[model samples]
Target: MSNLFTLSSKLAAQLDQELMGPKVGFTLQQLMELAGFSVAQAVQKEYAIDDLNKNKKVLVIAGPGNNGGDGLVCARHLKLFGYNPVVYYPKRSSRTEFYGQLVKQLDFFNIPILEESDDWLQYLKPEQTICIIDAIFGFSFKSPMREPFGKIVDEVSKIDNTIPVVAVDVPSGWDVDEGPTSETYITPSLLVSLTVPKPCSKHIDTAKTSHYVGGRFIPNHFAEKYGFKTFKYQSTEQVMKL
Candidate 1:
């Protein structure tokens, strides 16, 4: 796709609302699967490019919303593809049953669910080839810095290693419209913007990082209706670099 649209947080939220509600006819489960699969495709691309250690593990840091659900789903797919993925999901919203379903699926796969109190440093090894999937936040996040999440983002920033991070949508702690508040934000090595990227993606320095647009489930009519700028994701490809 040569042309792409940059969506404000409000517009992104609207699209999600329409799709998840009765009008769009896409359920939380379906959307989660599409997102998870798209992320899996991106991860495979990274693993090949970096020659990451097969024996080394993947860590998925997930938040409390559907963003976290996407991470949970990603972990399951990674495991099925023969990569060990550990989840660090600290919270869950009571309003959505999808979160519970995601948890159950991860449990069925026997993937490890890291407790919030666990020391994350123990999982880090400077020389080891590790990849972190930051699914900690999405379009719904607001900022001023909260408790454990703030601490968690701090921890991620402190990791002084080449362990490439793949952010699912918007990077955690980043503003969808305002971009990053500081350079200390979680700058991922690979960013997979689901369906269409949010406005914050414009802040990403393409010279130093790889950005991609995935999530192939958006219908053409919806794209036209929403005025999404175009891209050409051929049938053989699931993602396109930005």
Candidate 2:
């Protein structure tokens, strides 16, 4: 349960720049590659739990950003690991070329991708066993959730009892530093914090939900700069519960 420590959204960005910035740092290309794979591997343990019946399926709600890209990567791994994962990604705007590549890779794997619609909530079948993967928003998200995302988060909240949601980094619609500003935030059964735990994650109810540190790609130099305690996430294993 002990680890490097928690960081605010601002400090999280600072840590990213220190290790993944321009010169003398890992390129976004390299970072994204490692990031996607690490995330997939991190949550693999949960996907294969013996108690989870094979009747359960995965529902991935992805946004059009790096976070969504990570979800796309995770979906593929979920499929290869023997779980059926269907993605709901509304690709309205082109966030970046890399984003396209992520989608392309998902398609290459023959994963089913759905576009955002008014009744996207229909995908969560009440009669069927399911788990959600919230990849909608990451740390950069600001307050006042927008149209599709706001409604989507609210919808997901409604289904928490039937299906457990596993948020990728920060929970969708949650404040990056403090936590959810309102009850509308989607409460995840499992929250996987990449690299290090963010400040807002401190608010998560560890007694009820599982919180793990993932993204075992950052180098030790960055950890030393922040005086981190070598966390054992980006080192020992692909993912470690904190």
Candidate whose TM-score is highest = 1
lDDT of 1 at 179: 76
The whole-model lDDT of each prediction reads 0.79, 0.75
Instruction: Write one digit per residue (lDDT tens) for candidate 1, span 5-40.
Output: 788888888888898888668887898898988898
- The deviation in Å at residue 17 for candidate 2 is 2.2
Model 1 scores a TM of 0.91
Worst 10 residues of 1 by lDDT: 120-129
Clash count in backbone of candidate 1: 2
Candidate 2 regions exceeding 4 Å error are 1-4, 49-52, 126-129, 233-236
Candidate that would win on lDDT: 1
Candidate 2 TM-score versus the reference: 0.89
> What TM-score against the true fold does each predicted structure earn?
0.91, 0.89
For each candidate, how many residue pairs have backbone atoms clashing (under 3 Å)? 2, 0
